[model samples]
Target: MKIGKIPPDVLERLVFNRRGAPRREVLVGPAIGEDAAIIDLGGYYLAIHTDPISGSIKLLGYLAVYVPTNDIAVRGIPPMWLSIALLFPPETDETLLDEVTKQIDLAAREVNVAIVGGHTEVTSAVGRPVAIATAIGVGRRYISTSGAKPGDVVFMTKSAGQETASILATDFENEALKKGINKEVLDRAKELAKAVSVLREALALADLATSMHDPTEGGIANGLAEIAYASGVSIEVDPSKVIVYREVEELCSAFGIDPLETLSSGVLLATLPPDSVQEAEERLKKLGIPYSQIGRVTPVATSL
Candidate 1:
């Protein structure tokens, strides 16, 4: 078992195959690469995403909200509500709980989402605090990860490993410092964590994108592979064109972690029809979000 996500084979063989029952309302249930589940809501589609914060403690509350919310946003929807659960170690105190709640409150307020309901408790089963969130959003029209068409252009927002770099610097500061990662570099990586949410950018390109996915757990390479797998299309990504920050490279090199397979919560991977590429680029530019054309969708499924 890995610290990140369950491997695809295990999910397919054990979980996906044993889903309890079939429902007419579930337009999208469990599937590889599809982050949020969509359900028919009469006039609109309800997109739901549930994710947990496990690896880093630096911004646990904040990450809890954004990580799951990112999935809903990529489905062409803005997360308007959330239900959260916070689990704390037995030795944790009230002050720490209050601070975490404060953090969650602040982030929820910033995104205009209400913390509708949730539970909090201290348990001896866990060593540290972990936050889990289930975000709900509604969209009139939504895009799917499996909608990528052949000849569609693949695109990415921001650099890969933004979350991984930030977490490494904050959680393993001593190790990073010993490895000659400068104070300024570490600070920059920490700062990058605040910009993890892709709600605004996702909304901007929602209409133009044929498919969208947030690269978490498995990073950019896996994210691209998912797009290909879900859509049944082959992706040819130019490794050189995929942006990997120097700081990320240095940090990952020092830690012996694969940045491409690490947790990357902020980056968005999208595919667009050739005719809509110009509009997508323009919208991203207008939003001041840096983007790059990594590759194109091919007719045949191939290696990432």
Candidate 2:
């Protein structure tokens, strides 16, 4: 198993295929690109998503809250509540616990989400602290990652690999400096962490987007691939149009990781009707959110 997301084939055979009986209320279940599980509650829909923060130790608490909530946001709903499970090793100190809790508290408040309930434990089952968060929200209308259709235009908010750069800068600062990455560049990259939340942008574009996805573990390329696979569409992306921040590129270059394939939680990928592109662009600009028109969705190729 890789360090990041499970391989698609493995997931289908071991996870997706084994899902229990279906229900009418489950509007959206597990799928390649779907961000959250949506359940119909009479007139409204409930969106729920869970994510674990295990990649970067320094940002575990912050990432745990934002990552899962980002999933709900991409579904066009504000995450109203969160349940976080904190797992720490037996030797962990009280100060570490306080720090992580404070981080979670601040992050949840920033997104206006309430931490209703959760569990905390110290055991030998884990070597490092891990924070898992599940976010829930309600909305009348929601978007799915599989809603993209042919002729729709693909758009991306923020830049690629922003989270990855921040992680490397914060968690692997010494390594980055040894690779000749300057302190100033690394500092700039660290600041990119604040941009990880796409809640505002996702909500702003919710009405306009046919589909939306929070590109996390796989960066923009993998995110696009998931959208194409889930929607049964083909996406033609212009590499030149994909925005990669200069600091992100520098850190990624030093680390020898593809910016397009690294974990990118800050970026939001969306598809919209060609006619709605103008409105979407205008909305993003008005909100002062940077974005790019990266490609178009097309029909999947078929043999003659």
Candidate 3:
């Protein structure tokens, strides 16, 4: 525990000062904790966001870029460019850095986005190498977390704890096998970890969505809290219908963790039009994506 929290005055002093300027071309400027910004050009509205790697290192830089990219997609946008803020510990190796850069490049290529500019530094301030990427993209009619309607069908594109299970397995392979995780499960874990990008299905449903969000650091439960809070609706997870891998459930039980609370990547939650739900699921199936309908967003419930 922290001995003393940073006082408000000290917290303000410790932060970087933003350059304040109002340019007509800049629709959104430097703001505290605003994950993404927006800019309006003559014919398009561009949404931008950036985030860093903190938890897992196997594909740290790669996942760093996509986490925010998923934000763009969830809001019905297509990511087109990237500007990265990569910080590394002083003892970092050039070869490891190269591998990280290659992963970033390959991932961006898979989504066909250009790497813009940002800072790269090796510093004592950073304990682990951190990759912070700022992504910019275009949108037509953007979906917001606040857009979920009371009756919108709550839909998911993949299982709960997909990335979390995969990351834990990769990070604790030896320990996991002793606990009964097999080759098949391990392979499945790696496959899920490798499945970080969440833009494809999101962009496909962009026009049809009223609201959406990527299930990331805080998992589906946290995601539900946000959507419910923002849209003023209540969502219930039919625990029976939530598709968590059996091994993932076992792993969570072994560690005394809630599978619902584990970080989930490669999944998107959409508050889709009731008329469009089946069509959207079919679209995801046609694209070879795995998905399941878990629940519905009912009118704000008094019971909860």
Clashes of each: 0, 0, 0
lDDT of 2 by residue, 1-304 (tens): 6677889999998999887997999989998999999999999999999888888878888898889999999999989999999999999999988888888888889999999998999989999888888999999999999999999999998889999999999999999999999999999999988889999999999999999999998899999999999999999999999999999999999889999999999899999998999999999999998999999999999999
Better of 1 and 2 by lDDT: 2
Q: What is the lDDT of residue 37 in candidate 1?
A: 95
TM-scores of the candidates are 0.96, 0.97, 0.85
**Which pairs in model 1 have colliding backbones?**
none
* Per-model RMSD to reference: 2.0, 1.1, 4.3
Off by over 4 Å in 3: 1-35, 302-304
Deviation of model 3 at 181, angstroms: 2.3
The best candidate by TM-score is: 2
**Clashing residue pairs, candidate 2?**
none
Which residue runs does candidate 2 get wrong by more than 4 Å? none
Native-to-model Cα distance after best TM-score fit, residue 188 in candidate 2, in Å = 1.0
Tens digits of per-residue lDDT for model 3, 1-304 = 3432233345455642444566697654433222356677777888887776666766776786678788777767788888888888999989878977888888888888888888889999989888887788886656667777877888887778877777777777777788777778777777776677788998888888877778776688877777787677888778787777776776666656687877887888887878998889888999998777778887876764
Candidate 2 vs. true structure, TM-score: 0.97
RMSD of 2: 1.1
Please report the TM-score between candidate 1 and the true structure: 0.96
Ranked by TM-score, top first: 2, 1, 3
**Which 10-residue span in candidate 1 carries the lowest summed lDDT?**
295-304
